[model samples]
Target: MAARSRRMTLPSLAGRIDPIYKPATKPTSDPAHSAAFIFLHGLGDDAEGLENIADQFQKNDKVSYMHWVIPNAMEDRDAMTTAWYRPSPLTAFAPSRPELEEEEDEQGLVKSAAYVESLIDACVRKGIPPNRIVLGGFSQGCALSLFTDLTSKKYSGRLAGIVGLCGYLPLAGGSQLQHLRAIAELPPTHGDVPIFLARGKGDSLIPKRIWNITLKGLEAFDASSVEQHEYEGGHTINGPMLRDVCNWLEKVVPKLED
Candidate 1:
């Protein structure tokens, strides 16, 4: 096993970012970093709040070779707290979803997606391939990650996988998103990108209706590669879920040398 190192603080761009970056504990390849997982923390949380994932994985040699990028969400002025994007409360599902058209924060969503891409760009600049990178998040972070995978022009269908926990798909029924999805023309690889989504059975924020809707939206997007997990809890993570996430990360971005 490799020795643990201090966490490295990476600057956010344009004064809206500060991410905790952890390099692989053990080098699995010549350059020492074989794969990367960029995770976004939920609303009201910072990168440090989600640093335990790195603490756990770095000690385990199986995935210790992975570089972890955990980022903080910028402040949502409306809510007066940190968030990946502005939170627009979801109204009940109706055909055409006029609420989505009128209330969803389109500008904030696009900007946050770009921030995620910038994180990906940083990893690519470090020499990792797009297919070796996985994007993931919790709550608001999860929502933004899924949206980014669907809408990012350079990486829409090119990431290794996506992990969304305790989250619902945002702007699922909106016309603008529908049009963007159409224009994006997700390559066949988009469907091939594995999506690991887990929800808490007792989660009040994401009721049964919302989960079903999220699933349907993914299906409409032609997401054939997805793994859905259900755990006993509320709008937070549990032990079993974390264990499953570690296992999933191993499978998604495994050792290239092994």
Candidate 2:
């Protein structure tokens, strides 16, 4: 893997940005590209956190290949660390979607979604179609991935898949989100898009009840084309979880040229 530039200026947000880029482990037949994966890190974690994930993929010979791009989260002043959004009040954290909705920082989520769009656009500019790109993240990054995938108007059906790890969907069961879904201009399979969600039943930061609620909410939206998994551990990824993701990628995405 090589670093292309310190920061590539995005058309959407005209400011300094520092994102890490890792090329595919092997070369593809297409001189331009084959596929791409955009992964995001959890709060307080930077692009470096995904380096291990990229390494894991390198060991797998069964899946279609792609270049990996992981972007750093914007800094949050109140948290004194990098975060996709401001942290909700500690007490506001609950199992019910209604309570979760009340405590969420919608504004921050919107901004994070925009940033994600910029990254996706960057991938498109590289001659890769949106449908050939996979969007994924861990924890808070997972929340942002779902928010952007569901809310974005332009990139519908363009994405190959979405992978959420150790996180629950944001704004689940919210009236505003329901309104958006009703009026959303999504592709026919948007509701049926392949979504791989995995959470630890023992996760403390995000309760198991919330994960169940998220699962039901996705189902309520007619997102039947989902692969959900649960582990008996805590808020971290394990070998079994990684294998599941690898297998899903192999099944959902087309293989690169031989």
Candidate 3:
């Protein structure tokens, strides 16, 4: 109701990727943007998949001042479609046994993490600090978003919050993840940042065992700021779910003037 949506292309560290950027309708402090949310899409999807979300929020005057940056994932060479990382069966990504877990796409994860950081840097350059920025995604995007936020040395524990929709955590356990935590220097209070995680009741894309592991993994970090939800439908975003996310956003990123 207050701003117009436009197409944008931001250069990514992983490769030359075109991202859809939606500027906030009004600034929290006149002329200087207040808060931003850098949201990524799921595997086999691009920026368009999540662009409406920005529109959904901007229509509500409460969050019109929040900027939204949605980036596109490069087309997977093997899958022949857009993806944030190497194309792998989501079911296999997080298995029950650590020894039997699928080998993660470390290269893709690292590069994408760098790309996410670049997006954060872009927002920071625009005057928005890390504490005012929230990163989130759906499905594969959720996995990458959480993973990136968790491992990126520059942003771990510095973000305002994270929004993860219908996705499982990857590389959740083992000495490797611990090694990564050490490298990132995440503190015991890393859980201080709020999180919004949701799952579908009838969804088959994410198995029960893997989802449990995801919860367990988040607990390992003492992520007590989590608020999880479950919808009646399947692995798709619904109106109720969006409403819940919007409400969560209201709690995490309140009006600066308030």
- Per-candidate Cα lDDT values, in order, are 0.80, 0.74, 0.78
**Candidate 1 lDDT over residue span 158-244, tens digit each:** 899999999988887655666766676744334678999999998877776778888888887788888999999889988899899
List of clashing residue pairs for candidate 2 = 130-158, 131-158
Which residue pairs clash in candidate 3? none
How well does candidate 2 match the true structure in TM-score terms?
A: 0.85
Instruction: Single out the weakest 10-residue window by summed lDDT for candidate 2.
Output: 6-15
lDDT of 2 by residue, 1-258 (tens): 334432333333333246777666664766234677789889888888887888778766534357777888867888899999987532225546543444678789888887788888887877677877889999998888887888787664458899999987887756555555456655433466689999887888878767877787776667777888998898898989998888888766777555
What range of 10 consecutive residues in model 3 has the weakest lDDT sum?
A: 1-10
Question: How many residue-pair clashes does candidate 2 contain?
Answer: 2
In angstroms, give how far residue 197 of model 2 lies from its true place.
0.5
lDDT of 1 at 164: 95
The TM-scores, one per candidate, come to: 0.88, 0.85, 0.88
